[model samples]
Target: MLHTLCNVESGRLSRVEAEEEFTVDQLAAKVGMTVRNVRAYAGRGLIPPPRLVGRTGYYGPDHVARLTLVQELLGKGYTLAAVERMMSELPDGAMALGVFQTLVNPWTPSEPEELDELQLAEAAGIPHDPAIIAKLVELGIAERMDNGHLRIPNPDLLRTGLEVIKLGVPLDAIFILLPKLFAQADAVAKTYVELFRSTVWRQFADAGLPAEGWPEIQRTLENIIPLAGQALVAAFREAMAREIEVVAYEELGLDPNTLPSTG
Candidate 1:
């Protein structure tokens, strides 16, 4: 009787239908759980019971979805107690989605400001190594202007190098790591760009957002790129630390208890 009512009335119910028309058995079956277990979960306040309308009960799809969600979390190694707390204490998915948008979305930069080559070098504090400059010039990293001034061909390389200057590593050592690091950043950037192109663009188009919103969308994504890049670097650093501190330490004949200054 309850199954037939659910089938007949499911289409009539709003997205968040009133919970006064569902029974414990009906909700349990919807989430593939038994009635007694559903009742036990309700008793423990892990799942909320349906509303009672003069002894007839109903639950919305949100209730059914929550049950399935909890089951999935448990299957993914979360304790029932943890799932219960998460259900009670956590905000809805929309909140997390909003945060992801804020974090991952690109933000616009202020209008472009022009800085000349000399200004760029001074701002970046290019070391006065005439020999290195000559090598860079030969390698096409820097170029000579017609007016006899030197110019940086790729400004990002100079900026990234300046940014890492305070890390206490020698320039030669840093050079070894720079190519691989930039390559990793480039790969991660490509992934996000592809995601925006394939997924976000389609989503925006389907939602009928204006074409003018594209810049704002790209800005938000660009803003997110640095954050995502930093996150990847942090994760890599942890993994590298584990390998260097533990795995390689024993092979180097060092005591783990008396590890060298990691600082």
Candidate 2:
């Protein structure tokens, strides 16, 4: 008698020993995608391709997870090319921002360990200027505590400043830009707050609460913060491109002084 793998009543795969490595067929089955689709994604550079285990190509858990994300993003109107760019760019931007944060605003080790202006300057490894720090405080990106120490209102404000700088905008321009830009961001954040509060937070509530929420919060931020920044920047890039085109037209004014008018 011959038998095939079948799901019992739960309609889920039966619990079994999880494999550390999986073959192409197994990976395709696990990812709920076709073998051709997997190969196409690899060819298109949408994800890191599977590792070669001697004669057979084997995929690890990371590949499976990435494949799932790729599939979801594709279904949500993300083109393969865009998805590929996003996949690679997210990590690159995150790593770059991490370095920038270390330079600009290394987090204090713990509470009750406040930074005076001098220590803050030393920790950030930047030249000190009371005026500039005052400007940041005025922007509400930082604030003075009751104890006469400066504190970051939120670390993300520093990260966002670094991201703006990473886009090649100068520091003076950034100081000008962030105030306006972050006002826009405040409106943008409301949508995501609704999304998380309704969906993700509810799901977490259903699951047993862990010893600490910070670890889960950090993991979620790792996924979200970079992606949110990328989305905002893509919009800004499009807007700037349009602005440049218009500026070029205005700069090349059609006035008789600048252009040869058609007679």
Candidate 3:
């Protein structure tokens, strides 16, 4: 799905992906939104209109990406009115915005599933505690629906969490640690973004973001997103090894340096 192209401005090679398209219903499912919500957003100019063929309409991947963004922003309390204004403010219109959005979105998780409280309780093998359900909703893991079903966003995350809970880790302890983890991750993420903005993006902006240079910008941003994740994982592994050595030395009078090492 990846293809190489030359940036017309720089005459340098870059890569882009084949954009996927979907129907309204599929688009709704992709981003965990209702069909009505998608239609409404399209009606209000929040998203671009679909291409028409015969009587059916089809939305492109950009539309799906934009909806994902809208879901995240709205979950964080951004109103539709505010979102519309912000979308309008993007440079060089929707095409640029689409590529820009993909680069900027922190993470892309899988599609969600709608499960009732009873279903979730059974899946996770836990009691149906209202307090815990409320907390989950607050954390954006799930959304309580009008029909009393819960929309589990990032179902894989929920599954992993359930596995840890089943291993006897207290949910309360996990919740207490979540904020600190998020703060550290957020700080590291901002550092990477600021690095891009100050250097690569700054030069692009200085040149006025010429349309021909978009492919290079897209290429630059797309490449960094995964590299940032890899870098974080590497750094965390190194730090954890050091921490583990210290913990073992202090608690069990074990020194890793004295043990036979494997290369």
**Which prediction has the highest TM-score against the true structure?**
3
Clashes of each: 14, 0, 0
Give RMSD to native, each candidate: 22.0, 19.1, 8.0
- lDDT against the true structure, per candidate, is 0.58, 0.59, 0.72
How big is the positional error of residue 157 in model 1, measured in Å on the Cα after superposition? 5.6
Best by lDDT: 3
Residue 208 deviation, candidate 1, in Å? Answer: 6.4
lDDT for model 1: 0.58
Tens digit per residue, CA lDDT, model 1, 108-209: 233223444556456646646666556556654567666766666466666567677655556666666756765876788777767765776567545553
Q: How many backbone clashes does candidate 2 have?
A: 0
Q: Among all windows of ten consecutive residues in candidate 1, which has the lowest summed lDDT?
A: 1-10
Could you tell me the TM-score of candidate 1?
0.37
The digit string of per-residue lDDT tens for model 2 on 89-196 reads 322112222322232232333333346777766654557889878987888767787888887756655766756666767768878887787778778766665666
lDDT ranking, high to low:
3, 2, 1
